[model samples]
Target: MAQITLVAAACVLVLSHSFLPGVKGTTFTIVNKCDYVVWPGILSNAGVPTLPTTGFTLQRGETKTINAPTSWGGRFWGRTHCSQDSAGKFSCLTGDCGSGKLECSGNGAAPPATLAEFTLDGAGGLDFFDVSLVDGYNVPMLVVPNGGTGQNCTYTGCVGDLNDSCPSELKVMNTDGGTGGVACKSACEAFRQPQYCCSGAYGTPDTCKPSSYSEVFKRACPRAYSYAYDDKTSTFTCAKADYTITFCPSPNTSQKSSQGQDTETTAATTSPLDFNSTMVYEGAFEESGASPSILAHVFRSHAIVGIVGITMAVRWIF
Candidate 1:
């Protein structure tokens, strides 16, 4: 009877492990398709265990992979035009984590930076994610699910280079005093108005409506978060999947749009690729063509067998 009890207990334990999503946790594959080098910064949410490395450098055409445990919540952004000073302090023009080192430690990206946010293993065991312009726009970014399923698991991002056409009032000029802009500041960051910032009496979603500035972003990246209240169009979810984050995803895409010399016209026609209104992820100019893995089918097959084993174990215990 003692030996039977031990066998039954072990069987149940082994079978239960199969129920967890991302059995080995999720893998975040960061790829750099931008022409210049990018120093990627990562910040885990408060109370969550930090990832192995908070920040790292990715040269043009380079790639890095990081594994995040189940239930991990955090945000990622690329630091552009980075330099290390004589004192060995590292910083960047855009998306700087303000840690003064390659590792962000625990600091979040500063405003006027593009961000990709994630909450893994949330309600219903789904992974929630979004590319947000609420802080502002610096670099073009895209988020693609590797092997995930859910109606909302499709691609989401602001792939347009908005800096070149950023409104003069909201433009963050290149420190080099070049004619071009490097980052586009959010209206909230630029004016600090209660309406733009969605603060004070305007804190509620009802009161805080989309301003004209946010509309510019919405027109460029329809699927991304344009403002504090853009949740309905921006947020996405998936279960049991890896992810690929690409900066400047399209090879043909340049920092400046190819739509002649008119900045306003270029801004309106951000990308040559047609955005599918359906939000179904179609192959892009440079998509990796990742499809949902057969693991889901394998999981279903094993699940049935595991359930039978668990039932037998319970009968034996009884």
Candidate 2:
């Protein structure tokens, strides 16, 4: 009796060990922390090629998570643009300038070029890490890593102006023989004409007053903002603001998958193992636990017998 019991226990142990799933990969959660919106992309270590599903919208203060295969060994980073629309929503406008046309001059219809690409090293997994969204004006906003975070892009100034152009231009309501037919010729003229003013102060004969619209326009556009990123200085400068893009090293064991979702675990990581060091184990049950151990063994022992039994069972059940 003792021998029989021992044999059965040993069989169960072997079955459990053989049937356990294995860890297949690691995952990462990217957080948006910049002031503007972001469109994230995964890149290789050489930065030569992009990985699958390279594009995703990340509004300011939002987060997203992705999974990578255990076989992948390349670095991962993100590229951001101001024009990325939220999911299920269409972009009112496209290109780097956000919603408005690139240029306000001459029909004003050229898209702006992408401002910059932010890169980060890809590891086996990451927790809720912060990724920033920066605007053309070089403003920094926040985003959480993965879908666990909420959308809360901060608008320090006015919104809905599109174009993302600061010192926003005042809309001219009426061009009734103003200095320029459609737009203002100079700052002085914009204020002098009431029809062009957004305040609607100049349009009516009774209120024909020269408003300060020109001054406001100058305050918004102001010589076209310039951005300077000095690698040597390790700093980014725009207008009157400066920031540093720094990395925070984390322990290898501190990493965790985003939201504990199985689907997301496979998106951010690489595919089909490559470099040895780059590979990571997700767990032990991921690969081996597809069916019951007894069924698997029975099928393995006699393929014909199992096939016949399975066919009969399926027929009867259906």
Candidate 3:
């Protein structure tokens, strides 16, 4: 009986080892190298998110990190206003524009409001990341249609034709030989290229006619269309920009052991264990080694031996 109990205990220990949980660690580090300051945020697979504690102050080169959890994945993005001047208005002091000014060309205005979007994918895993400004100007624009109808158009359809007129706002202004309200007809004649001049009333030139604005916007803002930045090897010219994405693979925990040093391996390892698998093992062992039947047996045997020993002691004394 003693030997049987010892065997059972040894079995419990071996099984316990098999049931032990396997935890994985994942981490991500982001570096911001841009003139504009930013406060970055992070998202996770479980839908819980986090924001930077001190908020990143991107003056040129700065970095931060998010430590490991059960599983991790999401985007990192940020935005802030262009620095304002003493008069409490947006000012572009970074020399990002060609006219040595920060305001948009149309009546000292800025481009329509916009935001950046980024997407990331990993086959096995990824970690360690950096994003740098390719150029100084990463402003968002409200994409408008190509026609004279100033409705919101997709990025591809809004060739910077903010007003969505047949002759774009820019074309109309350039054609009228000035800015402001010049009639479409007169403006078309002034700005019409020889190839674009179809027999028309004025702004009705073939080139001035409505084409897809989305295509034009892509041509104009190819790099700015997406949220990516790369500082090295890319030109910072007005027409060219750059951004970057970097990551490291999460550690693998599914490796298997072989029989001997010279033994040949048979199969490839599987994906690292997940949080759900660990939870299942923990739940299975919640009442381990203390089943009701085992408890009752222990109590009954103790009671029977106590009663018999007590009776014998009393008779002997008498």
Candidate 4:
């Protein structure tokens, strides 16, 4: 009986480890705080494996969580005014992925879209992330790193709603000629000038200075990627952490909802992807001016080892 008990205890230890080793990936929780529905598109960096379900419809107030390899490098953006025809050809009026399907697969978002870009586990083991409007602007977005131990693991993004007052020359209007604007365009998108696009002779950062048009985006969103060379303050670094991406992340919205509340809406219904296959997660946080709390880890290895110890004691009785 003593020998049997020892064998069972060892088995329990092994089983516990099997259940815990699969949780090392970083988690991304995407929350939409806008008044309208948004279709989000994700694109992986070259040679990297694409995330599961590259595109999905996220209704207002809904949250989606995605687990990615610690070394994942990718960008995310929102597509507005999306629709599907009878053939299920999905497309968006702004920031379309051009896939003609709801799932973006490996497709990158078209220009004129606000981007949340990340490169995890890079040089010196630091994670770099930023909110880029260099491609253009379609919506206000923010990326907040949660629970990471590192210097300057703070939030990075654009909080301005540029569509409200986008310059007429750089505005992205609806085909219906609606009175209200839906998206904003970068000067490069509006005009193919090499200076604005940072191409030809202006390819280098020194020659590619911020133009008056880019300054408008900068003034509205100081921390965002206003132009191709807006890297001094736009880029942010951190250690390992879970990130939160929010669309239209106005502080007032968080104030009304009381800290990451989920008040579900409809017209377009979507649910979290399969947990077993995709392993995606969904969570939210209240908009806070205070520095992030909770040290940057979830289900630490020691915690799992503790579970193993507890299970071993139970199995010893067998």
Candidate 5:
């Protein structure tokens, strides 16, 4: 009888500690490393309480930390070239939340902006995060898990800027009259076709085939959401831990340069047949000749509107 009572007391203690303040939430440290000012924006999922301030100016090399509940799910992106008018109306040239005010409040970033998306404490006690270009590419973003217990709690994000390589048809210029590429639009967002958006008849992964535009995105950010059905290799899982999201993290010295060449003799090329047909199909997609460049990089470190995934949003309402 005494042992049973002691066990009950221990369980109660555990439960209490789990619900204690400062112990059941995730912390996000957002750092802006761009040359210009980046107006950072935050939007929580519906019914999920928002952070202190949804939008704020993050100067060059500035960093800010925000707290979120344990099971909170939302996204963050950097809005560039922002300003306030004489009447105190706020707006950004890129990654704008369309609030007409400095505070995004509960509004998510418009499409075409690079996104650092997160869903903490999800299935199997794992947190899911991804850099999404499905909406389009804006500023380069990276999600680095801080102390955590898991095998795949590794860094995941679009390491290199994608605006530079953005196809002509998909480039979204800076609203402030900047010359360089501000954001790269997803094919779906750019064209809104059933094939690109993966809607209607193209709902499943098997049906929604990768197009030329999507191929570029898939090859660039292999670990990011390139299309609506790009779920198999894009989603990453991690345990409870703080996250560090860096916008335009200083390009690495050896960041896959776009100049290098991979010359190979193909006079008499012969590929071996894989025992597994699935492996062969996978290899074919990989061998589509989308070489590495800055860890799936492109863009000029800016963004505008974008579409994340038109068909594959479960935990997030936006």
Candidate 6:
């Protein structure tokens, strides 16, 4: 009887490990290296499941990690100059999702915000990612892959302080007493012309060429998407890997804070990956154990197996 029970238990374990799809997922470690508070916003792509938290506050030097199921697609950004009014409505000067609260729900970031976009388990089973300045620049961001494969799996982001050098017409100035610039607006947002906006006849990538303004952004951030059609050098991909997204990744940022406060010394930037080094894919939930959502699925799977296994074991014993 004891031997039969052990065999049934072993079979259950094997089956669960072999067929559990929910066990596989990706992880994102978000870090804030800025001198002031940063509110990170997340928006899952339409038709996909939303992440655990859509938005949250991160103090200087703080870090938070979240998990995403395989094939999850979304974008992450930072909100600045946020405050709650007397009516308890939350708002931000830049990168606001317009949810009226910390959580962005299903909303995406407003324009003039730096964005880190991702599509996990995408075409050819690769994770496609990029830091885009196409909507314009509000902060310096870096996205680094951890333990992934493929030649294009590497570091990508915009570390330059574009606000300081932003063109006068494209700069979003701080409304507060400080005269410093807060964000840099894209040419499309500034002029709304067919050429810059890539609309009407310029809708196709062939018709839309990099404008002089986009060139400025490209020169500053070679790996980031500067214009709508800038995909060749901007997009990066990796297979079966987790990611770390850092805000204000530069060791030193000359741009002033959105609150117009004198910036303090910020944290040093992280070291880039050594390509020669070996990478091992440590799955998101595997390292930290299953999250609540994953756990729910895990338990449900086990319950089904448990019932069958026990019934078989009892029949064999009888």
Top TM-score model: 1
| Per-model lDDT | 0.81, 0.29, 0.28, 0.74, 0.68, 0.81
Tell me how many clashing residue pairs each candidate has. Answer: 0, 43, 20, 3, 15, 0
lDDT of 2 at 87: 52
State residue 173's C-alpha deviation in candidate 4, in Å. 0.8
Tally clashes: model 4.
Answer: 3
Write candidate 1's Cα lDDT for 134-190 as tens digits.
999998888988778998888788877788778899999889555578899999999
Measured against the true structure, the TM-scores of the candidates, in listed sequence, are: 0.78, 0.24, 0.26, 0.73, 0.72, 0.78
Ranking the candidates on TM-score from highest down gives 1, 6, 4, 5, 3, 2
Instruction: In candidate 6, list every pair of residues with a backbone clash.
Output: none
lDDT for model 3, on a 0 to 1 scale?
0.28
Model 6 misplaced regions, further than 4 Å: 1-22, 255-318
lDDT per residue as tens, model 5, 1-318: 665555556555654544444454676778776667888888888767666678888987677767665688888888877888999888876788999998897888888788888888989989988888888877867677777778778667775556766789998876565576777888998888999998999988889988999888776666778887778777878886778887765432122335652111110121211224342222111111112231122111111111122122222333
Q: On residues 1-318, what C-alpha lDDT tens digit does candidate 6 reach at each position?
A: 678868777877866764676456787888887777899999999999898899999998888878787789999999988999999999998899999999999999999999999999999999999999989999888788887899999879886667767899999998856677789999999999999988999999999999999998887778999999999999999998888888876533564457764332221122222223222111211233335665466456666777777777677777
**Candidate 1 Cα errors over 4 Å, as ranges:** 1-22, 177-179, 251-267, 270-318
lDDT of 2 by residue, 1-318 (tens): 665555556555544544355422233444454344645434333423233344456665565544433233332232323232345332322222222321211121112211223232223222212221111222221111222212321111110111222223422222233221111222222243334331355445344432343333223322211212112112112111111211111111112335554421332232211113222312211112112443444334444544555555456545
**Tens digit of lDDT per residue, candidate 3, span 1-318?**
665555556555544433344322222344343333543323333353332231233433454443333233333333333354577654432211222223222121122212222222232222212221211122222111111111211121111211222234432222313333211122213344432333344234223442233223323334332111111211121111111211111111112235343111221121111224443122211211223343344345445655555555456545
Q: What's the distance in Å from true for residue 57, model 2?
A: 1.0
lDDT digits (tens) for residues 168-188 of candidate 4: 988877774555567788889
RMSD of each predicted structure: 7.0, 23.0, 26.7, 12.1, 14.6, 7.9
The CA lDDT at 132 in model 2 is: 16
Quantify how close model 6 is to the true structure by its C-alpha RMSD in Å.
Answer: 7.9
